[model samples]
Every structure is written in C-alpha cells, then in structure tokens.
Target: MTSPHDAWLAEAVDAARECAHDESPASLEGAATRLRIHASLERRRGSSKRRLTVISAIVASMFGSTAFAYFTGWRPFAPATEPARPTAAPAIEHEAPPRARTGPGPSVPVEPPPLAPAAPPGEPAPPVLAAPPAAAPPRATVGPPARRPRVLPEPAVRAAAPLSPATTPAPGPDAELAAYQQAHDAHFKGGDPAAALAAWDRYLAQYPSGELAPEARYDRALVLVKLARWSEARAALAPFASAPVGAYRQREAARILAAIRDR
Candidate 1:
C-alpha cells in the first residue's frame, strides 16, 4: 500500500494536465477569431478612407472650377443685365382751323314728321307732301345784273389834233416855184430819165396852173420821147402845142409833136 500524500499528488497532477489541454484549444480559437475580426475592421476602415479622399478631391475640384469661372468672367450663376430699351419721342400734332360757315348760318334743323306704321302688303304707300319753296329769298333787288361799266374813250385817244401853230402861213408862190425848180434839176442834172419823168409828172399834177406848168409839160413830153413812148409823147405834146400861141412851151411843144409824127 502507498501513502496518502502520494495519492493526492497523482490526482492534482491529473487535474493540471486536463486544465492545460482545455485552455490551449480555447485560447487558440479565441485568438484566431480576434485576428479575423481585426482583418475585417481594417478592410472596412481602408475603404472608408479611400471614399472620403475621393469625395474630398471631387469637392475641391468643383470649388476650384467655380472660382476660376468667376475670375475669368465666365460665371455660371450670375444674373444677366437686360439691354435698355429706347423710349419714343412724343409727336406734335397741329389742329386745323374751323372752316367758315356757308349756306345760311345753320338754319333751325327742322325735324321730319314721324312715319305712320306700315300698311298691309300690296297697298300703295302714301306720297309725302312737299314743303313750300321758302318765299324765294325776297327777290334779291336783282338790278339789271350789274352793267359792265362803259369804257369811254380817253380825250387824247379821240380824233388826233393838229400839231403845228394855228397861225402858220401857207407856202408862198416863190416857195412852190423853188420846189418845182428843184424837181426840174433832178431831171437834167441827175441823168435818170424815168426819175425825171416822175418829177415832171408830179409838178404838173400838183401845180397845173402854176407858171412852170407849161415847162413841166414840155419836159415830160421830151422824156416820153426819149423812152420810145410815141403815143404818150404825142398825147402830152398836143395839149402844149394847142395852148395859147404866146404860152411858155408852145414852140417847143410844136417841135416835139413834129418830131413824134416824123417817127
């Protein structure tokens, strides 16, 4: 048989061995579970940090873009100013003057009589009575329609008056004789036979009873003879030849007559 101390030591030793086996498995399982938990927590923390960094960068980029846009005059949220509208100037209108009242100064507007109600169909309408012609305006003093004033002739325009002195004497015999002598000079001195004939004829017609009348006949007969007018020369010289025997041109007229008859 063994002692009691030896038996107690064996029991204690068995108990200690059993406790070590159970504690080692439990500690190992607890440590492995703690490592798995710690790994999951670390993965979650890393994802959260990356997401926060990305979010912060995106926010910073958006703020920078907005500030750049504001500085460069490219603002996205600034209110715009509308252009000013031009105001129109008021118009000045001038009113015209009222016209003069013609046609008898707006006579009392006579209201027409009201019409009767319509008669049955097919009945002839009654004729409207005409107004009297308003007394013909008092005949207007009519007065011969205003005779156009007569245009009397002016005193200066009537028969013209003589322009010379009333008392001027008539031309004398000597003056008349001088005119005849001047005409006679035109015949011989001017050497124009037709002009000489015209001069002699004028003297004879104007002064048939003058002292130069016979001389005018004598010279006119001579001019007719020079022009080959034999019949006129004969007729002209006949009167002078038959004149009184002592007449101024009687002998010359007879000589001219004889010369014409010879031709």
Candidate 2:
C-alpha cells in the first residue's frame, strides 16, 4: 500500500524537524546550565548582602548600648578623683556708700513748747440744779364721772383672772396662765363691765402683789369710771401715772389720766 512519493515527503519532514531542533539555542541542557550559573551568582550576591546587614545591625546595637550606658551612668568615663569646686570670687571693696555728713542729722530733737498756763481757776462753780424726781407727775385731777364718755376703755391694762386655790394642779405656769386667760375671756369679752370689774377685784384680792397687779389696778380705775366713782378712778390711776418716767406703763397711765382730766 505505500507510495514512493509519500514516503519521500514524510522523510523530508522528519529531517527538517531534526535540523530545527539541533539549531535552537534553548535546549534543555543549555537551559539547565544557565539556571545553575544564575543561581550561583545570586548566592554570592545574597551572602554579601547578608554580611552587610549583619554589620549594620551590629553597629546599630553597639551604638544603642553605648548611648544607654552613657545616659544611665553605667559606663561613663568620669575621672576617679573629684574635681576642685571653684570658690566664689572675692568681693572687691568698693568705696563705702558715701557716708551721711558726720554733722548733726536733718532734724534735731527739740522739747515741745511750754503749754500755756491753764486759764486761771474760774470763779467758784455755780451750784447744780436738783434733778426732778424719777416718777413725778404734773398735779392734775379727774373731772366728774357723769361727764365721761359712754364708750369703754381699751383692754391694754385690763386685769387677768383670779387664781383660785380650788383649781386643779396645772402642768406648768403656761397652763395656769391659760386658765386665767379663759376666765378673763369669759367676763371681759362677754361685754359686761360690772361683772368684769368684780372678776378683776377677785383677781386682785387673790394676787395683791401679783405680776398683773399694776394691770388690775388700772382696769379697776376704768371700771370705777363706768360706775361714776371719779375719785376712786383717780386714785387707782395715780400709782400707774407716777410710774418711773421710762417704765412701760408710765406713758399709757399718764395719757389715760390726762383724758380723764379733760373729761
């Protein structure tokens, strides 16, 4: 079955392929040889670079350790013997501050001028006027009770209640005083002057020298005015009007007395 021409063509093709393979510079053996040469050059170069890096690292580490030791005073090159400390420079003697003149100072001590003799003793001192009595009042009297106004006086000086022996024992002075206030409100606020007057009289009888005595006496005088007892009212108000000048009751008593006199 083989043709002669086909066999010749096939042979020619095979020969061409063999010639191309032999002429190519990149054969497997040549490629291997190049790779080996490049690898050796890289090895040589890498070793030199590694040596340079190690030297640089050694230099850096030495420098850092030297700096650390120097700063920490661990390896300082200070001398063993101590250096002499310089002394302070001797002070030059400048001329003493110019002295104040040796003569007397600016101001001389002097005795105060003699005081003028006190004015010759004045004529014998005049006698001093006697002081007025502390509780003195101007002489005055109450007018007729019939002429008095119908209106009742204020309770400023009204009397407190009578403290009866029959009363229960109170816890303290406050309770006792409250009881007295209750009685006062009963008679005084009830609008009965007569009953109020009687209640006040009983209170005064029980506590003649009580804390409310002055007030009771004053209220009694007012009640007397209501009952047309002008003389009794004047007598009752007399003591209060004569109270010391600056006493709390003095001004009020004086005022009431004056009103009575005007009436």
Candidate 3:
C-alpha cells in the first residue's frame, strides 16, 4: 500500500527518465536536476523523522514535480500558438521547365484489363494456368578443379630420405674400448675364458685395426692358450709374441708362447 505521494514521486521519476532522452539541452538539464533531487529524497526518506530534513525534502520534491510536469508537456500557462502559413506551389511552377518528352507532359498510368466477368450460376469456372517452374541456375566452376596435392612416391621418399648408400665403417675408439672392456671383464672378472673368447672375437672382427687391437690380440692369444686351443693359440700368439710391436704386454706374450710351445 504505497501512499499517493509515493505514486506521484514514482510518476515524476518516470517523467524525468523519459525527459532524459530529449534532444534539447534544457530538457536534459531539467531531467538531471530532478533525478538528483529524487536521489536525495530517497536517501533522506528513512530520516523523515527529522523536521528540517523533511521540510527540505518536501520543498525539493515540489520543485522536482513542477520540473517533471513542465518537461513532460503539462503546461497550464503555455502561450497560444500562432496560425500555420499556407503551403505555396512548388518553385518549378514559376519557371519554364525542360521538356519531359517530345509529345506529352506526363504519361498516364495504364489500368489492367478488366477481369472476365464471373461465369453465370451453374456454369463451370475457367481453369487458371499456373506459371512454369523457374529453370535452375547453372553451377559456375569457381575455377579449374583444385589441383590434387602431389603425393610423394614411397620409394622416392625412401631414396631421398636415406644418406648415401655407403657400407658401415669400422667401430670408433669408444666402441673399440667398450668391446675390449667386455672381453676383459668376461676373462678376468667372470673367469669365463669361453665367453671372453667370443667377446674378443667379436671385438677383433669389428675393430681389427682399432685403438686397443694390439692389447686385444695379446689377451685373445692368452685366452686361447687357457682354452687349450693349441693351433689357434699358436696362430694368435705368433703375431705379437714374435715381433712384440710397441712392447705392449711383450714379456707376457713371450712367456705365454714359450709355455704353450713347451706344452
């Protein structure tokens, strides 16, 4: 149950909001002023118990109501409007105009031929002919069909991707060391002369002239002697024990050879 004053205030607020859209500066200013007053009144509404505040809010409300009404076209004191001027003939009537056509000033609109009168009662009505279906528009070729992407031949790709078809070369120093270390471990640490022999053979096959080949050859001969493969031992030891190139394990190789020959 809102009071009449609340309803009037609501209408004033609505009128102010409507006036906010007016293109005129005066209406916009009046809307802004009324809105500010409304905001102040809302803020002091709960404080209506204070006499001074209520008096001021009421005065502001009166001013806002007058403003809202005046801006919203509620004018009891508006000046009488003057009579409107008569519409004059067009300016072209005063001047000689250029000829529109060689013959006529303006063409009259043609009326459609009157439809045939309805058939007399009980006679059959004429059949209406329908327009034919429109032809489908031709499909335009936007351009030549998009060229299919060229697929790479698998064989050609394989050929291009691979490096030159050169044979794998000999093992590197690190690989040589790794192979020799494996044989050495099998021989000394595991005490398996047969496994050592296989590892040595693998190392020698891959790295015949590798960095550790001299050492590997000497060790392999000892390993063959341990295995009692006399012929292979003789063949293996003879190369290093006889010449003892670089004196690498020379004494060891010679001692092993003499012992094997004695055996």
Which candidate number maximizes lDDT?
3
Candidate 1 lDDT, 1-263, residue by residue in tens:
86544554565566556656767877657655655665676678779989999999999999999899888978458678998998988988988986544344334456666677787889987876766454433222323356789998877747676768867666679877976887789778988888888888777777788877767777788888988999999998898788899786788888878877967
lDDT of 2 by residue, 1-263 (tens): 86544654565566556656776655545655655665676678779889999999999999999999988879648778988999999999888786434433345345555554455577565555554445434334544446656887667975877888799653455643553564477456767777777777776666676666666677677777887777777778888888899875778778878878755
C-alpha lDDT of all candidate models, in order = 0.75, 0.68, 0.77
TM-score of 1: 0.34
- The lDDT of model 1 is 0.75
Candidate maximizing TM-score: 3
Candidate with the larger TM-score of 1 and 3? 3
Ranked candidates, highest TM-score first: 3, 1, 2
lDDT of 3 by residue, 2-73 (tens): 974687588787877678677688887777787787777766764664777779899999999999998898
Instruction: Give lDDT: candidate 2, residue 54.
Output: 100
lDDT of 1 at 43: 72
Model 2: CA > 4 A from native: 1-179
Give me the runs in candidate 3 sitting further than 4 Å from their true place.
Answer: 1-160, 163-170, 244-246
Rank by lDDT, descending?
3, 1, 2
Worst 10 residues of 2 by lDDT: 99-108
Please give each candidate's TM-score.
0.34, 0.31, 0.35
